[model samples]
Target: MVRISQQRVKCIGCNACVEAAPYRWRMSRKDGKCTLIQAVEKRGMFNILVTDDEYDANVDAAMHCPVNCIKIEQV
Candidate 1:
């Protein structure tokens, strides 16, 4: 499985993630940060269980991150 996490503090509000992958990313009105659309709370950051269909887009979103806040890992 693929797991995703976002470190909001490192986000630059570039909206790259949102533009690249609207299905899983969103811009926060309160902080203008990029957040996982359907993420669940983990230790601190938001986490999402991703499928193979979303892997590429999510990875593209992570790559588009200006501050490199998004993390994708296999589990």
Candidate 2:
């Protein structure tokens, strides 16, 4: 499994993440911040678990994030 986590409060909405992984990330219309799709919010952070198929794209998302708010880990 792959875990994607984001410190959403720190997001700059640069769209790098969305560009890297459209399936797992998106631009929030309300705040212009990047939103983690299907994530559960907790303490200003968003998180989700996905299959390994999503790993590479999401890893790209994490690497492309200018603010370094996105993180990915294997579990």
Cα lDDT of all candidates, in order?
Answer: 0.85, 0.93
Cα TM-score per model: 0.87, 0.97
- Candidate 1: tens digits of C-alpha lDDT, residues 1-75: 789889777788999999988988888999988888888876668888888777788889889887888988877
- How many angstroms is residue 74 displaced in model 1 relative to the true structure, after the best TM-score fit? 2.9
Look at candidate 2 and tell me the lDDT of residue 58: 89
- TM-score for candidate 1: 0.87
**What value of lDDT does candidate 1 attain over all alpha carbons?**
0.85
Task: After the best TM-score superposition of candidate 2, give how far the Cα of residue 27 lies from its true spot, in angstroms.
Answer: 0.3
Q: Output the number of the TM-score-best candidate.
A: 2
* RMSD per model, one decimal: 1.3, 0.5
